[model samples]
Target: MKFFRNQIENKKDKSKKEDLAGASASASENYHSLLECLHHTGELKSQSLVINQLKFMLIYLETMADPEKIQKLILPALHKCMSLADLDECISSAGSVKTQSTREAADLLLEGYCLITVDTCSEFWLLQVRADIHRPPLEPENEKVVRGSHIGFVEDMAVNLRMIRQRMANKKLVFRYLTKGKETNTKIVLAYVKGIADEQVAETIYRKTEKIGADMIFSPGFMQEFMEEHPYSPFPQFLQTERPDRVMANLMEGKVAILAEGSPTTIVMPVTFFSFFQSPDDYNSRFLPGAFYRILRLISFVIALVLPSVYIAVIAFHFEVVPSDLVIPLKTSVSGIPFPPLLEAFIMVFTIELIREAGIRLPTPIGQTIGIVGGLIIGDAVVRAGLISNMMIIVIALTTVSSFSIPSVEMSASLRLLTFPLMILSSVFGFLGIMFGLMFIMIHLCKLHTFQSPYLEPVAPFTKTQYKDTFLRFPIRKQHKDKASEAGGNKANK
Candidate 1:
């Protein structure tokens, strides 16, 4: 209780300080007001420089402001200037120079821009000197492709935008920027192709994005949760990817992408259920091979979501479905097992999930070792100890492999999570329960929408034209033989 009281007292003290700072900031006298507002902030820096007999004060955030740019370019050029006109002429090459009010100046300072103030000047110039700190674009670990460009989006928004623009030279591509988060003030960019993109969808996304007023937004996921229509749904509506090429492709398909300043992943909006199943390899490989793998992935999705449940249902309640040839072996395998199918399935599934999660969180070499031990050693020991049957182990292994085949990490996770409920339902009602669960998921997918675009596009509404590239990849162009050449009909030109 004393600790709680102390915490409350500390918060009250902070609030009082903020109120005092706010009151002091509004009382004009520019320089004093700025200093008072920045009080208690240790990173606030002020430098005094003289240029041609005129005294000036430059204020900025030390951590965000670039020292080399300030000392080498700004100060040296300003030292030779005689007046505001000369100052403007000298610093014309410096990008984004503007005169701002006190509030705007304060915001600029925090963004790494130096606020330049003369002794008697009422307004101050805000110069861009923000530090460039970002990781170089590296191939995404999860979205790897063998034949396509490996470069992926970095945390830097400007660099990510440049990567897209570098590949797509179309002038119609547009970027609409908005600032979200009250405390963080994170920069977000909504990118789309002008004529090709659905204007209504773009407008809806922009409106919803602008409406976000969170105190802090750290990632694309934050924006997604805040604005997605069905936030409670396990399946992700917006497709997130780190590849700039993927963003460009989606833009061409009339989809919009949302990029957050500090996030490496960007979200493509109005995506279909099939969109998450696609990979860069689909376009890079031959059409037949691509379509084959695409169909295989779809099958994998079904298998991942229902195979274990089907096994449980059949063994527990519908053992007659088993073929006579395999029934003896199946019976022998389960005869030694002590627990019922439901409990046995749950235990093994939970163990697989635990191992998979630990493998991800641990370092790579150790993770691989753990996977080998858990999958081989632990699994073998459990079967020998009669805790689980060999057939159950096979079902779990196939389920794990199938889930890993999904291209999107979010989609894969959702499929894995849905497995538990389906398993429970199937254990209760056998094949009937599995059918009911599938029906509900289908209905949910049909009802889901992103920015008013159907979630199950080309399937629910059934557009045949999109099928050329949806489940299959068709060649971009094919030459047609001229009938005139074959039949010799055009004699006039000859």
Candidate 2:
């Protein structure tokens, strides 16, 4: 209450200061006579008309005011009126009437839409301005993979649209632009194939985007929370790809893509679970390594999400399930640990998350050093100090490693967040909790949709032909032109 009162007093002091400032500003002498001097207003008292209507008056007026004294005086806002009046007219003609403030007065003195009044001749100025401020093009940090195309999304929306369009040569590929931000006029574009993509998906993208009412939106990530299909779900409902080729592929898959002006990344909508796992490099790189890497990523994703919880559940309640040989090792590792297995696991996992978050927020070199030094110092010290068991450290390290394996940064973030609740669930019900959580996850995955397509498509639908790309990648010829494709079964990129 004391702090609150102080805060209120501070606000009152600020208001009084503002009021004093306003009073000081308004206390200045009225420059009405000086303002009148800006124009030769003959109607005002003490008017010193400068421009002569007659040649005789010009010389006489020059003499009336001392020539040396008049020479020192200057009119600041003086502007020559540009008007078309008939030279042949004797005081009147059809088009000779001066169009002053009514028709075209705004153009005088390089005015910005404000009308310039010079005895009332108006000139309308055409005013148009584009954004002058722009962030320099930089490689997308979110979607970095060693072997993939180095060209990532930049802040320029037009450049992003061109990158995706260059890959998708189909004339049916449509890019629709809309103006957002009431004051900023931020340009946002939605790109998709006209016929190849589903019409409903395009509508959904536009509808969701139109509803975004933010004071400012910097990245596609800004729109994610407001426009997501499931607000409460941890999984990313949209797939944001830096690679244009990846976006083009999603377009072919009947999904809609959104590109924000001044944002380098393009958001592909109705993204499936497989879309996050798949990458442009997967299609571009050597098939065997690519397929193996993709499979490993899926495995790691599961491990990242479940490893800690499994360790806790097993150690806390399911010890009978462990082999006798392994039991001694586990017992020895956790022997001196004071906390329960569940609490120990939580401590390690939470600490790892804290380190990861810090690393992400820190500068590149510093962040890398922190990740390395922090991991080594903390893990070694904690285990040696007997604050946490070695097994707990291993489980946390593995979980962190698995979290990093998923290709999509956003998807990995979603998976990482889910680890905590799952950990808690496992702590209480053991394997039953694991089974229930997995079932819930599966149900949620089945229910989630991006645009209009099921997020767990091909897998949920159980398409034999589609799994060729999901579980493993079939060679291009086999996927595109082989006998199987000709048999009207394969439609991987179509």
Candidate 3:
């Protein structure tokens, strides 16, 4: 029995030595391949070092790596190191890792990690030395608010994630990283609460992100177009916001947020038509005031979308609906205009759009000056010249104000565009045309699905329980109780 045991132990030792020899050979081949792959790039830099008579090579990209950290933290630690184990202990960065694959080492080098290769070791070390350069989290210009946290997302994904984690420290909040864009290789993060967010929804988002085949994805808009169910729809399927608080609020309500590197905007999915009208200021104020402003916004949506069309229809085909007292004055104001109501409407709307675009493209001070000069001077000159009617001016100005009141920029722009089609319909067919246009819009809203979630939720599906928070803000305690009761009912049913 002792002789057989000794023979077995010898065989095991020989097998172990053979495996070690194979690994060392593979590592040597991989090291050379990694160097050859990166040699063509101008930013690829390398240095050789001798530690206790052992040869070592350091490789990294100069544009992406931190020179200060390599000089102060990495080089000094390497000078004191005697072996691979000492190298690990001397540099204490948390992002250190070991790999034996050449492809993985090349990827790490491009991602701002320093690769350390030793002549006698079978694996290489990767140390995080990414450059820290980003703008401070200032308030986003387009999404500014009056009564809430002023912090907004920056272009850096790490800083954005840190801000989110700082706000909500719950363990349930989870993030999954994905890399898309064949050429750009942009990094995207999917964030959701583990239990609160639906598992199926998360899975769907993952599948869609994995299937994105674009070569360049520089902004959130690119991903939005690819992932949205209906790319041609005028209404935005995903809500884009730069506010971390807004993201946190949606995460708590079982929605997913898609954040991309190098973009400050975040895309929130499974949003409803009502989501575009909500503002953080609504929740920051008293519930009654919040509800009032929310309802006002919804009213503005109708006014902005259909008000100009209503005016055109009335003036062109159904002048009998006008009040008797104001009819004469309206006719008098419009009598001298040579163009028909349709052409008059087009001219003014087109002019307003031009002014709006100019204001956006120019610098802040110049844009403001252009808007004031264009609105006051051009509007008065056109009216005195009898090119446009006084009543039409009033209607167009009111429509512009209402469109501006919408909280979402995408939704506001959609409304502005939808206005023209409705105006054309009303001009041709009167009140009947306006009604038909509205019906078509309503049908589209009902049929639209964002990741299988109804776009017109709580209205088309007719959920009375969700009505408390849809068009109006309910009290916090009441809303929570309702949600808890609904959750309990769902669990019991299941």
Candidate 4:
């Protein structure tokens, strides 16, 4: 019985070898056909070499393939080689592969691999000769921190993933890659903790990204507009950050991060409205200072969004709300203004926006000068010209400062944007219009969802457990033991 089993196993092995040989033959034929298909392209380079009287065809893309490697490294090694097997053995000095599928071989060529096809052998070899050219990782201009890792992500996806892996060093950290953009073939990586991340949320995000059919995906911000639940909404659903520490922190909390090649910024998903308000600087400091700054940022959010509107409402129709003592000066300041409250407010706000934008677009040294000189000159000139009131200037200046206090630039910009509509409404109907605008914003926040997780989060759905980390940071020892729960996976309402 043992002899019979041995004989049957030998036959199976023989059959497997035969099948592999047949497949290789077909692959070689298909590879020739693929070469013919690409023959018309001017960059398709080919060279012939004879080793032990056997003719071999070497093919590569001229633009991407390294000529130095082919001449200095590859040819010297292949000179004495007679067969594909020997060639493979010699090329072990560098990364090379023997592939059978023609489609795969073509793909390898695109990736800067040199293909060697021997006339006598069915299997072909692909040699790696990719030239890497990219800028070194530098501190991101937008996400500078007072304390923490100064190294930020560069445009290279491999380097970004390496940095992240070095920090995490966890087996559960899974990075699933996908190629979007039909024309650009842009690569995107979705990273999450396998067991910690909510499976449903991750799967939904994966499906949405996979379903994207755009012709080109340029950057992380460009891709974000497509993946967000509400493109029409001013608020950003995903938090964008250049800090790998922030990305790793979010991953530990079971949130998924999307990283696109050619983009330094990465997107963190299933974020709450509060997520943008929090910054890496917060955790870098002591609990007391971090919590205090966190609270201050939240207050800034309110002040930035409503300060101008409140000013408009009070001066236009709700003057009784102001203290009687200050009313005289306020009235005197506005009495000389040539326009109504809304028009005056709009002129000052528009001028500020223009100055801010110009300052940003100018060079740093020039931008500071522009911001200081332009602001002082414009503010003083407008006040003297009676085009805008001194009180309105103060209100607008406060509003700008409050908006600037928010850590996230996108959120700060959105807050600034909401100011305009509220100002308009408050100008017409005073307090009632302001209330309506607030209600509309609240309803919009409640209706918004990120990966099916509520945007308003603990506040709207009333999840008491999450309050520990919401508005305030609790003591470190008071954190929940189940780290995944902090992700708010189950606590969140759809």
Top model number, TM-score: 3
Ten residues in sequence with the least summed lDDT for candidate 3: 18-27
lDDT of 1 at 124: 70
lDDT of 1 by residue, 1-494 (tens): 99999999998997675454421211234556676566648787788877777777778889999999898867877877878667667666646556545566777788888777776555576778999998979999899998889999999999999999999999999999999999899999999999989999999999999999899989888888888889899898989999998999999989999999999999999998999999989888887888888888999999999999999999989999999999999999999788988899889889998998899899999998998887898898998798999999999999999999999999999999999899999999999999999999999999988788888888888865566666766654421133234335446556
Better of 3 and 4 by lDDT: 3
lDDT of 1 at 202: 95
Candidate 3 residues 152-224, lDDT tens each?
A: 9999999999999999999999999999999889999999999989999999999999999999989777788
Ranking 1 against 2 by lDDT, winner: 1
Which of the predicted structures, 1 or 3, would earn the higher lDDT when compared with the native? 3
TM-score of each: 0.89, 0.73, 0.90, 0.85
- Candidate with top lDDT is 3
- Give lDDT per model, in order: 0.85, 0.66, 0.88, 0.84
Order of models, best TM-score first: 3, 1, 4, 2
Comparing candidate 1 with candidate 4, which one achieves the higher lDDT?
A: 1
Candidate 4 accuracy as TM-score:
0.85
Q: Clashes per prediction? A: 0, 10, 0, 0
Put the candidates in lDDT order, highest first.
3, 1, 4, 2
At residue 309, what lDDT does model 4 achieve?
Answer: 89
